[model samples]
Target: AQSVTQPDARVTVSEGASLQLRCKYSSSVTPYLFWYVQYPRQGLQLLLKYYSGDPVVQGVNGFEAEFSKSNSSFHLRKASVHWSDSAVYFCAGQNTGGADRLTFGKGTQLIIQP
Candidate 1:
């Protein structure tokens, strides 16, 4: 079984500033990972996913994540954040060891400071 963790429960950034939400995994095997965001009163929306090849993967809304097998990390980044980008971001992973159930991180709440 594999698990993910977001070290910061909340992150604050100025409007139009760059942002990065970190996600670290605890497993010898690199699990397939995905980043999701949840807006107020809305279900989670998939931002990006990584399985193989291409260490960097692009996501919606000017977001991207780089996968590092050595560090066991998949940190999500955005060049600039908008007010609407305020949301709870989650990192999830699925172990390739047969069980397809997804393990999710605690989530980080992104606050856009005006």
Candidate 2:
């Protein structure tokens, strides 16, 4: 089974500032990774995903992530964030088999400061 860990349970960043949310994964083999964000009382939205292409992948809303197999990480980053970016971010992955369901992290809550 694969798993993901979010070291920081919460991250506070001022509006219009850059942001980075760390995520580490553990797996027996290379897996498909993804980043998702959830707003209050809303369903999760896909931020980005990594299958087997470039290490860096761009996502919606000016978000991006770099897949680092050597480090066992797929961290999310944004050049700038707004109050609208405040949400819970989850790192999830599934084995290459594709039959197995995705394993998600505990999630990191991003707090936007005024």
Candidate 3:
């Protein structure tokens, strides 16, 4: 079984501040990893993903993440976040043999303060 853990349920950050969202997972093998962002009433958009090869992956809207096999972690980072970046972020995974069933965390709601 594959699972993910997002330590924070909500995060508040000042506009233009650097941000890091923590994510940890439990799996016997490396699975397809991804970060999705959901705005007010919109659907989830893929931020980034890691299938194989490079450990570092870049995403849309100035988002990035690094995958660590040893720690079983994939943390999202941004040098600076805008007010519009205030949205719910979810960490998800897909198993190779599961026909791509996405497993999502509880999600982290990010609030931006001016």
Measured by lDDT, the strongest candidate is: 1
lDDT per residue (tens digit) for residues 41-85 in model 1: 999999999999999999998999999988999999999999999
lDDT score of model 1?
Answer: 0.92
Model 3 lDDT per residue over 9-84, tens place: 9999999999999888888334689999999999999999989888999999989999998989999999998999
- State, as a TM-score between 0 and 1, how close model 2 is to the true structure: 0.92
- Against the hidden reference, what TM-scores do the models get? 0.93, 0.92, 0.92
Clashing pairs in 3: none
Residue 110, model 3, lDDT: 95
Residue-pair clashes, model 3: 0
Q: Which stretches of candidate 3 lie over 4 Å from their true place?
A: none
User: Order of candidates by lDDT, top first?
Assistant: 1, 2, 3
**For model 2, which pairs clash?**
none
Candidate 2 residue 21 C-alpha distance from true site, Å: 0.4
Worst-scoring 10-residue span by lDDT in model 3: 93-102
Please give the lDDT score for candidate 2. 0.90
Pitting candidate 1 against candidate 3, the one with the higher TM-score is 1
